[model samples]
Target: MRDAVWRHVDGRGAVCVVGDDFEGERQFEQLGVNPFVLRPGEPMAMYHWEADQEDFLVVSGEAVLIIEGEERQLRAWDFVHCPPNTKHVIVGAGTGPCLVIAIGAREHDSLGFTVDEVAKRHGASVEEETNDGGQAYARFPSREPTAYRDGWLPE
Candidate 1:
């Protein structure tokens, strides 16, 4: 990751460093916050809430937003907020890349959540995740990789 500063924006939520300098980018840093540039046909890996605050906004393209059991269509300039502990997912919904901004809090200070919690809420079983360092991402029941056949392949 590159060194970047997170700044506060009044109506725009937060902004942090994202994208290559050539591609352009801004991001936010806060509990439960995460943002990304979604390529076409990219399906967000399903994950659930942990103890932390979270938020989402669409800067470009379009996407299908799933929170709890409800689903909504989002386009450029659209925004959505997921309450802490709510199961949520987002999938690309347009021809172009979906520019999405999301934020999440650290697990220490707030309620912690894992993918399993999110899956359970969404009526699916949870799985475990391991990083290249061989660290377990979730302590609950061990789960499978988000994608079985292809890495980062859209669902």
Candidate 2:
């Protein structure tokens, strides 16, 4: 697990479970699974949607969910189900680290990053609508492999 840990340029962290020999690349064919760790105010990813379905479960701490232009508070054990093209993003909230388990289809016909005002308010939106990840995250640093830290999950 530690070997598959990585830190995003934006300070979010994640454990890519089905990675390629610790390179943090998903190795699965049908689905992908990851556990994301986020500090307060940090977003798990840009506000975007895919052509396939996705699901998320809050494992610990708290988070704020921005979906389809609305905001909702999330706590431990909260589960979110997103059908195809349901735009959304999750931001860390409360006083500590937020751990969320994300599961989704590995293949999709399309993906898109949206320019959402609500996501922007939480620093999680792209400057403009785009399907390219590089364009959507142009202002952020790249993710790098990192040593796993303790306490990212509940004991």
**Which candidate leads in TM-score?**
2
Q: Write the per-residue lDDT of candidate 1 for residues 1-155, one digit (tens) a residue.
A: 12343332221222334432223332323333445545554444444444455678787778777666566789988877766567666666667566677755545443322344434443332355322112322322322212112211122
Candidate 1, 116: how far from true, in Å? 10
What TM-scores do the predictions have?
Answer: 0.51, 0.90
lDDT of 1 at 19: 31
Off by over 4 Å in 1: 1-34, 107-155
Residue 108 local lDDT, model 1: 41
User: Candidate 1: what lDDT?
Assistant: 0.48
C-alpha lDDT of residue 50 in model 2: 93
